[model samples]
Target: MIEIQNRAGVERARVTGRVVGNMLQALRTRCRVGTNLLEIDEWARLMILEAGARSCYVDYAPGFGRGPFGHVICTAVNDAVLHGRPRDLRLADGDLLTLDLAVIVDGIAADAAISFIVGAVRDPEDMRMIETTERALAAAIEIAAPGARLGDLSHAIGEVLAGAGYPINLEFGGHGIGSTMHQGPHVANDGRPGRGYRLRPGLLLALEPWVMADTDRLVTDPDDGWTLRSATGCRTAHTEHTIAITETGAEILTLPGR
Candidate 1:
C-alpha cells in the first residue's frame, strides 16, 4: 500500500521518526566491544517503551522469517546483514556490527539502520565497505524529490555501490513506509532511471543501501532462520534513513539530530 500522508499524518510521522532516530543514536553510543547483542536489544526495548513507541520488529512473523522476531533490534555482526536476530554472544573488538530498527509512535512508523566497527578496526576493507553504503544512501537521498521516478533513486544508489566494487543484493531493499513498517512502491537498489513509480509530496519511504563485500548472494542462517549472511562469509555493511517527500525535495526524518 502506497500512502501519502496528510499534514496531520505527516506531523505524527515526524514525531515517530524523531523518536526512532533518537533511540538509534543512543543505542549506537551505548554499544561497545564488551556488550552483548541481546543486551542491545533489551536497551532498545526499554528506550522505545519509555518514549511511548511500539517496536515494528517484536511479534513480527513475516514469511521470510521463521518466527515472531521477539526482539526489538536487529544485531547483525560480521558476515551477517539483514534480519539478524540478537544473540547472547558478546561483541568482540573490531567486529562489524549493524543495527536495524523500526518503531511506531502515534500510529506512524519510522525505520533506520547503521553499520559500524565495534572497536578499533584495523581492516581497511571493512571501513571501505561501511563507507560505501553510507555514501550510496546519501546519493540516493539526493535524488529523491517530488516528480522524481523511483528508478532515479535506485540508479543513484547502484552507481555508488557498483563503483565501489561491492556486490549488490536485490532481495531486500527500500520500501514505502507510513502507518505500517513495510508498504508499497518497492524500491530496488539497481534500476534504470525515469522508470517505475513516480514520487510525490507527503510520501514516506525507507531508503536503504546495503552491500556485501565479496559476493551478492545471501544465505539464511539455519540456526536462527532469520539472519542473512553472505554466501562466501564476506563482510557487509548497510545504511538507511526514513524520509518524507516535500514540495521541493526530500526531508530526512531519521537523522540523529542537530
Candidate 2:
C-alpha cells in the first residue's frame, strides 16, 4: 500500500527514523573482527527495546522471503546483500558488511541500510563498490522532492551505478515505506525520467541503491532461505536512507543526527 503521511505522522516518522539511524550507527561501531552475526542481532533487539520501539522484521512473513524473519536486523556480510538472516558466522577482517534495519515508533516506520568494511584491512575494489552505492543513493535523494517524478530519482541512481561499471539488479530496489517497512511504488534503480508516481509532500520513501561487482543476478542461501549473494561470488554493497518529501525539497529522516 502507498501511504501519504500527515503533518503529525511525518513528525512521528522523524522519531522512528532517528532510532533506526542511531541503531545502525551503534551496530556499525560494534562490528569487529570475529564478531558473530547473532551478536549483532541481539544488540539490535536490546536497542530497539530500550527505545520502546518494535522491530518490523522479527515477525515479517512476506511471501518472497522465508516466513517469519525472526531477526531484529539484517546482517549481510561479504558477498551477501539483501535479506541477510543472522547466522552463527563470525566476521573477519576485510569483510564487507551491510546492515539493514526498520522499526516502528508511534505508529510510523522508517527503513535504512549501510555497508562498510569490517576491520583494519580494506580492499580497493570493495571500497569502490561501497562508494558507488553511496553516491547512487545520494543522487537519488537529491532528486527526491515535491513534484518530482519517481523515475527521476531512479534515473539518477542508475546513472551512477551504471557509470561505475557495476551491474544493477532490478528485482529488488527501493520502495514506499511508512506504517509498514515495505510498501507500494517499487522504485527501480534505473528508469526513464518524467514517468511513474509524482512526489508529494509527506510521502516517505526508502531509497536504496545496491550493486554487485560482476553480475546483476542474485542467489539465495539454500540453508537459511534468505541472504542474497552475487551470482559470480563477487563483492557487493548497498546504501539506503528514508526520506520525506517536503515543500521545497526532501528531508532525509534517517540521517544519523536527525
Candidate 3:
C-alpha cells in the first residue's frame, strides 16, 4: 500500500514524526550502563500517551514477526538488529544499542531509528559501524528527490556501506509509511540505479541503512521469536529517517524540530 499524503496529511505526518523523534532523542539520553530494556519500553509507552499519539508497534502483527509485538519501541543491543523486542536485559558499557520507533498522530504516521553506544565505553569498531550507517542514511536522503527512483536511494545507501566493506542484507530494509507503521514499495539497502518506483510529491518513505560488522546473514531469536540477531553475533548498527517527497525535493519529517 503506497500512500501519497495530501498537504493536510503531510502536516499530520510532521506532528507524528516530531513525536517519534522527540521520544527517540529522550530515550537516547536516558539510556545508561544499567538501564533495563523493559524500563526503556515503559518510557516509550509514557511518551506516546503523553504526546496523545499511538504506537504502531504495540499491536503490530505482521507475517514476518510473531503475532502482536506487545511493545512500544524496539530496543536492539549488540548483535540484535531488526524487530528487536524489548526484554529483561540491562545495557552495558560499550554496548551498541539501536532504538527503532514508529507512531501515529492525527491519523498520519512516521517511523525512524537511531544507533548509538551506551555509557562511556566507546569501542572504535562500534563507533565506525554506527557512523557508517549514519553516513549511508544521509547519502540516501540526499538523493531522495522528485523524479528519483527507489533504486537511486538504495544505491546511495549501498555505496556507503559497501564502500566501508560491510555486506548488505536484503531480507529487511526500509518501506513506505503513512497512516500505518509499514507500507508498500520496499526499499532495499542496495540496488541498481534507474530502476523501481519513481519518487513523487506526497510519497513518504522510511530509509534505513543497517549493517553487521562481518556478515549479511540474520537469525531470529529462538526464545522470543521476534528479535533478529546477526548470524555471526557481530556488533551492528542501524540508522533511519522518514522523508516526505516534496514538489522539488524530499523533506525529512522525522527530524526533531522539522
What lDDT tens digits, residue by residue, belong to model 2 across residues 117-231?
9996567999888899999999988878889999999999999999998888899999999888999889999999999999999999999999999999999988888789998
List TM-score per model, in order: 0.98, 0.98, 0.98
The residue ranges of model 3 lying beyond 4 angstroms of the native Cα positions read: none
Candidate 2's C-alpha lDDT? 0.92
Which residue runs does candidate 1 get wrong by more than 4 Å?
A: none
TM-score of 1: 0.98
The residue-by-residue lDDT of candidate 3 on 117-231, one tens digit each, is: 8977567988889999999999998888999999999999999999999999999999999878789899999999999999989999999999999999999999888999999
Residue 179, candidate 1: C-alpha displacement in angstroms: 0.9
Clashing pairs in 3: none
> Model 2, stretches more than 4 Å misplaced?
none
- Please, what is the whole-model Cα lDDT of each candidate in the order they appear? 0.92, 0.92, 0.92
